[model samples]
Target: MEKSGENYKVISCGDVASLGRVVLHDALALTGAEVSINELPAGVSVPFVHAHKNNEEVYVVLSGKGFLFIDGEEFAIQEGDAFRIDPKGERCMKADDTSAIRFICVQAKANSLEGFTQSDGVLSETKPSWL
Candidate 1:
């Protein structure tokens, strides 16, 4: 499901607990980043390791247990764990044999962030509707 207005859009990604990946770039008409919600069942690993040519990736584990293999090093990951990988870092993920894993991966051009919330946000005279 989706809804849109002049400058905002919202989409519902029902039941991320299931196994699969849902890419939101095209769905949300994203211009600067690609985001995906992914789920892997127990004892499964991505078929191949991969690295991006220009974009770095950040992964936020939403549930369960997993391991991230990056540049031949393995790191344990579980709910609330987040990590960033450089553009050229070889990476793959596997869910532990005991449970499924779900995560959100966000990719954007490496070194492209010049300003974040504190520096970029501007106070507005307009108040939020609920206020």
Candidate 2:
């Protein structure tokens, strides 16, 4: 059974995997959505290079430099770069031999606009309490 509570999920990239690359799945709890962090070693590319049938994705580059392939086209990416991919677009990425790549990938059903907007978020006054 699940209960309401406040918790923190602290993780380190090395903790997820020690291989040349790693994909940390469901790093955070998000309803109707998915989040993952990918760490790619130099010159290594993601294994999955296919398109999704129903979900679109956003890639946020956290560190290093790399190249992204979308729909058979290539684009250079770097730290602080963010881009979206349509569900029907084929995608993959590779890190440069000089630097590794760390990025976050968010995925959600394309039709669920409301879900992407965080409409379910609640704003409430904090309960009266003394520290």
Candidate 3:
């Protein structure tokens, strides 16, 4: 839970496997949406390349270098960059050279542990096996 008198949650960042030190600034509860700030090191990649059935997302780079893959199309991204992905828009990202990449991630709605899935390069909604 977040502390009072604050609208942000500062998530401690560090080496997450291949991903380097990164902070997850979660603002989902505050904004009533899935909005977050992430500080990623270079040579790191996000967890998956999937989409949300009932949520939309966006990423804005604060620093470092990387590429944004949206629907299989790659685009060069750098500091002070922004991109938005609609609901169920396939997406993923990878940092280059352990470059410090700070970006904002927003989700329209929170999924109950069962995030969307990708099958045969296609995204679809499914129940989480753990549920």
Q: Among these predicted structures, which one has the highest TM-score?
A: 1
Question: How many clashing residue pairs appear in each of the predictions shown?
Answer: 0, 0, 4
- Residue-level lDDT tens digits of model 1 in 4-74: 99888899987776638999998889998999999999899999999999999999999999899999999
Q: Which is the leading candidate under lDDT?
A: 1
**Model 3, range 13-39, lDDT digits (tens) per residue?**
344434443334342234445555575
Overall lDDT per candidate, in order of appearance: 0.93, 0.79, 0.66
Off by over 4 Å in 2: 1-30, 115-121, 127-131
Q: State TM-scores per candidate.
A: 0.94, 0.75, 0.60
After superposition, candidate 3 runs with Cα above 4 Å error: 1-28, 109-131
lDDT of 2 at 55: 95
Error of 2 at 59 (Å): 0.6
Better of 1 and 3 by TM-score: 1
| Candidates arranged by lDDT, highest first | 1, 2, 3
